[model samples]
Target: MAKKHKPRVKAPKTASPGEVMEIKTLISHEMESGQRKDRKTGELIPRQIINRFECKYNGETVFSADMHPAISANPYMAFYVKAGESGELEFLWHDDNGDVYSHSQKLEVA
Candidate 1:
């Protein structure tokens, strides 16, 4: 079984309509590239990494990224979102092994 990962997201609790706000996200994961060998067994460690990341505002995609093996563990990303209305900002991370980590924050736009 894959290990549990912790996802973190930061967004403004309130903002003015049409305002541009900075959003930050981070996930705790050990991104193994599958190229390294086990010290004792001398076997290749299975590759495990976050393969994709996406952000949605009010159910609409705002930002997305495709990650590669070269990405380091605990990936951190920051992006900008233009406030439109009060809604949910959802963050999702897709792992190579069919695992998905998700988090959401409410944004109140006036």
Candidate 2:
């Protein structure tokens, strides 16, 4: 079976110059622990999770985290960054299935 990818992000459309902005992100994933059994066959489900998450502003990394299966379904993340005149905020998620999901937001500085 092929891996699936999904991503979500929340970012302000604009911010004042030199101001700080908060960003939130989440990815839809099963986060299976490999220990879980299939309901029908009682077979162990292979572990699957979002192993890494990163945020970049104009190509510079601002925040990042190494996630594990213990996190939760649909891993959620929140972080802050300083906003300057106009730039792009990029979010990335790497899944255990070797799939990478990414999303980006562009904003204006007031």
Best candidate (score: TM-score): 1
Over 24-105, each residue of candidate 2 has an lDDT whose tens digit, in order, gives 8877788887779999999998898889999988998889999987898888998898887688888889888787789998
What residue pairs are clashing in model 1?
none
Give the residue spans of candidate 2 off by over 4 A: 1-4
Model 1, 81: alpha-carbon shift in Å? 0.9
Looking at model 2, report the run of 10 residues with the lowest lDDT sum.
1-10
Q: Give the TM-scores of the predictions, in the order they appear.
A: 0.93, 0.86
Each prediction's Cα lDDT score?
A: 0.91, 0.85
Q: lDDT of candidate 1?
A: 0.91
Candidate 1 lDDT at 48 equals: 92
Tens digits of per-residue lDDT, candidate 1, 65-104, equal 9998898889998999999989999999999989789998
The candidate 1 region of ten consecutive residues with least summed lDDT is 1-10
